[model samples]
Target chain A: MNAGHRSESVPNASRLRIAVLAGGVGGAKFVRGLRQVAPEATISVITNTGDDLWLAGVRVCPDLDSIMYALAGVNDAERGWGRAGESERVSAELAAYGAGWPWFTLGDLDLGTHLARTSWLREGATLTEATARLAARWDLGVSLLPMSDDPVETHVVTEQGTMHFEEWWVRHRAALPALAFEQVGADRARPTPSVLGALASADAVLLAPSNPVVSIGTILGVPGLRDAVVSSSARIVGVSPIIGGAAVRGMAAQCLAAVDVDVSAAAVARHYGARVDGGLLDGWLVDTVDSAVVPELDSEGMRAVARPLYLSSLEQSAAIARDALAVALG
Target chain B: MNAGHRSESVPNASRLRIAVLAGGVGGAKFVRGLRQVAPEATISVITNTGDDLWLAGVRVCPDLDSIMYALAGVNDAERGWGRAGESERVSAELAAYGAGWPWFTLGDLDLGTHLARTSWLREGATLTEATARLAARWDLGVSLLPMSDDPVETHVVTEQGTMHFEEWWVRHRAALPALAFEQVGADRARPTPSVLGALASADAVLLAPSNPVVSIGTILGVPGLRDAVVSSSARIVGVSPIIGGAAVRGMAAQCLAAVDVDVSAAAVARHYGARVDGGLLDGWLVDTVDSAVVPELDSEGMRAVARPLYLSSLEQSAAIARDALAVALG
Candidate 1:
């Protein structure tokens, strides 16, 4: 049942190849820290595209840009999304025109990325191609790959009606009680070749501490994606988005409730379940505050470690990434 | 044959309904001045759509925005286009992304218009519908109607090959030595109902001093558009873009050369010819420097007058508009 038993252990950072499934803000910060800890290691990020949407006729890939901006050092850490020194002139005008959600604003700089991506996509280039083109602008230490070239927009079913995940997350600020989460087109969407290749070639695959229901959940929801990760020779590890009994960031608690899952680190680890029993995680990383769950997870045939998961600073994030890699390599 | 033969003439500005054919900078300035002279009159501008193009996945109607911004008092007078207090943050990023034209930059506020328009278009709104939505944002005194809802992009045939009018004008600065100007969709592009209705109900139709070969030329090129103007009860008048054997603004001289027309006031009026001779204009306004052409135009059955053609001030432009109306209503 030990995932480490099948693969040759990549003991040194220089020889390591890690593939990560990530989303916005929280995921981006984690990847940034991962880069800090393993500067020489090859990191390929399979970014969640369920957050991608059409705003004012332009394609905005939220998760992909988050990782890109963070890695390029242009991301606004304080605001949590978008580039620093960003202006809202265009978004203000969009609001005036009654186009795009007034609540969910796109900065002028971020609009540039949307414009480029939309233009390329309209010109017959796939989402993966558009992603590569946008990523090329930055000296992002990691290669960014979209989960799929196909549209896989996450929609939330509220008691009233079905709305886009962004409308629920951004416009309502997750106030809407989601009855269910649906990745529309996930049934037909195949993970991009780059993503599959990254998984196949990886020495370790990590599920970043992003929203498990929409971000990491949507990526794994792709047709062949879950099978690729579960069957890959690489040791698969997942860092819990929950610390103690609360979400690290975003609306992970609300999301967990929508899917009838308890809001706790051990509960989420159990939700992903153990790979030997036909679930995702070979190892699970929980916060030190929830160390009680470590023994519970280990007893379930999954390697478990409790570490300080707060990404308060670069050093802390790097330490967490280092801890996660250690648990996977072990 | 005199245009003044039309039965009813509303001398009172408040009761007047004047329609004007217009393009970007020159036309916007002329219409602004026209509004000053007839502030109480209902002005309906039939804007040239020949300059509209898809840039970075958004429909950019250069002439329409120019007039809208100018009328709204948000125009950048120094730059001759776009809104004042503009920022190029979006454009700089666009250049880095290699999306839009490198030479022709769109300010952030201006991009808002393109985004709104493109969004509406993608949502099944016609160009006319989109223009109405955009114009509704500002208290632009005049009704802004596109020449046609159908695409009518002006293309320049050069010694090398055909290129978009904007590329020939903005990127090449009209230095490519245009051999001919072709309004690409003019043959199939019918005048919008609003534009035709504006002309049919107008007291007089004034031709703003925009480029003759591209702007006005392309508008008139629309199928049945010229017929609507000629047959309508409205007296048709044209303000010359030429002065003292040279173009008043833009590459009107180059555009004239491409069509083998001499760059002179008399030559331009003759190019339009007399309505009695089955041409577009019933009267013409020329700069005082070229007063010698007045007698020549009159003898050729065209009512012509000389005036200060410079739109240096609102007062000066108002004076020019008044004089041009006098010639048309004689």
Candidate 2:
């Protein structure tokens, strides 16, 4: 769809209340692009907190910090995470003292966010409230919400042992083959009120190009969150993290293999399944290289569109965001 | 007495099981010098923990760290506190996040120690065990023991309101007139077993040139610590922090005034009182500039000696330590 047609079909394009489900780096990048595509739209992000962990007594919410820093224009674009012009003196010191994961470097600036969050949390603020307090520091141009107020850590079961997802991903570099992924505490985890409200009132919902199993999958795993998204009247569109037959970033292929899923755009779409068949996705966005999967998605009762999904720059990301929004509108 | 005669009187001086009561910078410097003077002595330092507090969820034992870093040869000599080559990136970030006292800068390397201490404490280790664990990282020749394993935060009662001792000292620079200093939790805080053992079997006990009202006073306030020192068979000698009528460093003068004590070497020695008169000091060493007070201290039933007490260099500090040890031997 063209811009003119999109504006005509989506009457209040500038005022559209868009909600996004996101993970860390990829999710943050996609959300940044979405913000550029619809500058005036009310964007609410329900970010996955499964990757959150306490390091050196400081609560570190990787996904939440990534999104906040990206939107605040301080994210290290080159490293693709943490604050720009960051220093690791604290991390090095922590390592010297044998505190925190030596492999997982927490930048000085990034630690500031964790300390702030931990302080608030200790002062009796829930995770959601602490996130809101952290986000309030910058004019993020969108509302950031955690998937749940309660703790829900993602633990990857491997041949060695059940390790934290971060320990598996960062420390071991995911070299250890995972047996399964467990969202510890998710059974009792409930979506925050803001998350439910955003889903219930959103004009459209977009799933960023985050890891399907650990990111978006974890958000959906939050007891009531998936049901809310499924029941919302808004059309839900998902952008594939995989292009061709491999993950666009990180170790999504390893994650997919652990879940016994093929590392392909078609497999990911099918993993989300179809909203018509008691699943989540109304539309699935795939890269042009995976255009061949459109027919299979359509047969599965989900619309599939192919586009240049690689977000190398803001322009490219905005273009992809426009495509996802177009699919949601359709 | 001359050094040669003093050495004759104190046989096997190098092997003396000397225990020193200490606070932060001044105390650390004195302890470091004492180690240089008697490298083979079984030195046990009972460090003050009243200044210890939780900052950004990390336990910060200022006095213990100062002595540890000093003895480990990693202390910032110029600053007389914290680690050498330290960065304030984390502190700046913490300030930006509004997580800790803006006035008190926690160096990156110092923060690592806090992280380690906090981690150990969380894992059910007492402050003594945590200190031991932290000290194990470096070859600190002396055994460092916190005055008490239990928490004993010194809260300064100021006209404005009660504030943490650190806030009163670092933030206000002791400009806020303190009505009194309260060693909160000291009533239940017990000196660790090691502390008691060190005192009981000590050949000699030397008091570091630290604040008499807060540093040394707070340690003595720990329920049984003062009694242990009083009852110990070993001779107890104190090095006055006051030279002439002023503190050698920091706000000792202000602290002395708060307690309604004269800011003089004799007054402080008298404040500790004579061990014969139910006080804690057997002998007192004062700066040569305060020699006028020696006769008065002798009249008060406490042996007094005058020496050059300024520790501007290691040599000077070593000489001062020699004098203090001579007083203990006498």
lDDT by residue for model 2 over A101-212, one digit each (tens)?
7888988888888877887898888988888877877888889999999999999999999999999998998999999999999998899999999999999999999999
Docking class of 2: medium
Give the per-residue lDDT of model 2 (tens digit) for B155-263.
9999999999999988998999989999999988999899999999998899999999789999999999999998788999999899989898999999988899999
Model 2 residue A324 lDDT?
91
DockQ agreement of candidate 2 with the native complex: 0.65
Give the clashing residue pairs of candidate 2, or none: none
- Candidate 1 falls in which docking quality class? medium
- lDDT of all predictions: 0.88, 0.88
Provide the TM-score for each candidate, comma-separated: 0.95, 0.95
